[model samples]
Target: MELLDQYSLSWIIGLVVALSVTGVIAGLMAGLLGVGGGIVIVPVLYHLFTLLGIDESVKMHVAVGTSLATIIPTSLRSARAHANKGNLDSALLKSLAPSLLFGVLVGTLISGLVSGLVLSLVFGVIGLLVAANMAISKEPAALAETLPTGIVRHSIGTGIGGFSTLMGIGGGTLSVPVLTRCQVPMHRAVGTAAAIGIFISVPGALGFLINGWGVPERPPFSLGYVNLIGFALIVPMTLWTAPIGARIAHAINAGLLRQLFAVFLFITAVRMLYGVWA
Candidate 1:
């Protein structure tokens, strides 16, 4: 048990403040970096749950599920902003939708069976990889002149959705890399990936809701694994800030921003991994 388990007024105030900061940063990353903010949100939620004395068996599940739920609104706001800026790749998004949904379903099912330790490991490993890539690569050269199709498309789309669901992220974290590899410009890659997040998040969030139903040891005000209070507090802030990130993404160079974010991810990833071994 932790100090916050008592849920005193001071604890409540502290929680709100923490959640508010999380939402603001998550939203900014969603719009500015094309990630659904799951990368940021999941670890934050995990630590918060730990502080609240949430059972280790279900804390990671709750974190992932709740992160997915939050991505829905953030993705929508970010995607729309990207569209307005003429950065979205609609054709590619349409082609990938079905597979993404299928993957989310599959991932959600798997999450129900996996232990919290395993989930933490997965998040940590993926976060480390993503952070390293961002920190090391100044420019990702195009490997192909066009988007993937047929089996490749199916594999990539499904993988993006499944992996993202498992990690509690929107598709952007993976899809942006894939798109850039396919020769999509940075702006369009980010924009299109933002749209792809919608496909992954909507279905992923619902799948988590159903998957977590009747599960034991969930935090208070939880509907399945999604904490209603966290959802409520985070959503409004994310929605308000996402578009601002989008505007900034379109207006300026993001290389420095990516570098700074990579550093943050690296630290977060290490902490997550350490928690697993500890």
Candidate 2:
């Protein structure tokens, strides 16, 4: 019994260490790339949950939910840093808010009905496409000279929100590319997307909280699908590093940033896909 207790204690320590490291990386990614760190957080949490012997049926749900919750603070800090640097587009942010919220609601509802495998598939496929685009086209041509208005803009915002929620992202991965395609500069797009993450994460997290309220086999200290322990473990490190990341984003070359982001995401996506198939 003593040996078993030691083994369990060791596992707990290792998990905590891993989560701390994940938080650091996630914070950097959120600030540097406007990704809200959800892309990094979700996968790491999923793997950790698996190691913890969480039930397979709800593993992805918890990961996604917890990721959205963590993003709230990281995105807030990242956006504030970018705003201080005059990188954010306040007008664009205002226009997209309503539709983004709407889409998050739609996504949360969908999440409740899907299997963990399906969510993993969505994450892998989208991650690959986003990575490929970033890798191949550092400076994509503009599709329009200015941002769209009315129904067109709303539709795009809705899609970004829905997809991001499904993937446990902050909408930066999709929004940055779309903004750039509309003739927005890379840095501005990135900053704007960081703000956009706020629109997605708050409502998305709440939705997950309500959606998973009574689910079985959740990790200890979970409030619905969001694991409080993971949130607590990850938030502090991300809070500490996120501002630093935002500063680095402004200093770096835009093209190099895209390439680096692409490489990291490509590896992550490939690994996620392999997990799905394996």
Candidate 3:
């Protein structure tokens, strides 16, 4: 109520409607695709914030931080649905969590150091590679039955964390392919990626919040860089739709799913690329 007092009633209504729609889309995408909804949320929030007149300097931060916060519950819900079918690799999830959190913190720091357009470029490039890998690769996930250990695994986990954080996406966008490449099954990879989202989203969101604390020129009701209103509105919709996505993932053909997911990733990548100039 008080937050809306800063703007016209129409603007507040429009913002709420947009966030609601975003929640639905992100939630379903995360559930079906095992992502944290960051890819979708980041762009939507960035443009929406611009329209709402957020400070140019901080708009990207707010969008990213809020996306991370919103992904936490969405991913958890999706993870639960997948776990019910024993599709999750708990050990792999654990392996990725700690280093991933650290990487996300590192990424948050990197965010302040880099411009949004630069970050968008990086996001687009990585996402495009991920999309291509998923779409074309048909080799058996026969690299290693057991997960890798020591520095190699940790290093990769850290990289995933940092990249996802920088891109404001749940690490699944990166992790699923890596898991499959490491010989993890597709369903299992998707399930575990959902679990990984918790690690990335929670820490990444906190990093942004603390990182942006007392910073000037952010939207109202912001906790550091995280927008409270957007997170609240988006989380519920994501919560509702994520389970449905998990259901679809299980029900569909694996190849078909991969193709569809690849398309989604490709589009997201191109959109991010476009945003660099748009």
C-alpha local distance difference test of each model: 0.84, 0.85, 0.81
Residue-by-residue lDDT tens digits, candidate 1, 1-278: 45357557776777778778878877888678756678889988888878868899889988898888988887787789889999998988888888898888889888888898888888889999999888875576777898778998999888998999999998888888888889888899888888888888888888878878999788766788887777888888888887899899988878778888889888888888998899
TM-score of each: 0.88, 0.86, 0.83
Which model, 2 or 3, shows the larger lDDT?
2
Better of 1 and 2 by lDDT: 2
Best by TM-score: 1
**Candidate with better TM-score, 2 vs 3:** 2
User: Clashing residue pairs in candidate 3, if any?
Assistant: 32-245, 141-183
Q: Which regions in candidate 3 have their CA more than 4 angstroms from the true location?
A: 1-6, 32-34, 51-53, 134-146, 244-268, 274-278
Question: Given candidate 2, what's the lDDT at residue 243?
Answer: 76
lDDT by residue (tens digit), candidate 3, 133-244: 7788567445676668999899989999999998888888788778887878889988999888888888888888988899988877789988888989998887788788
Pairs with backbone N, CA or C atoms under 3 Å apart (clashes), candidate 1:
none
> Model 2 over residues 1-278: C-alpha lDDT tens digits?
75345347676677678778878887787668656578878877887877778788999999999999998887897789889999999999999999999999899999989988878888989989988887785357789998899999999989999999999999988998899889898888988998999999999999899989989877666899998878898999888877788899999885678689888778877877887789
Off by over 4 Å in 1: 1-9, 29-34, 243-257
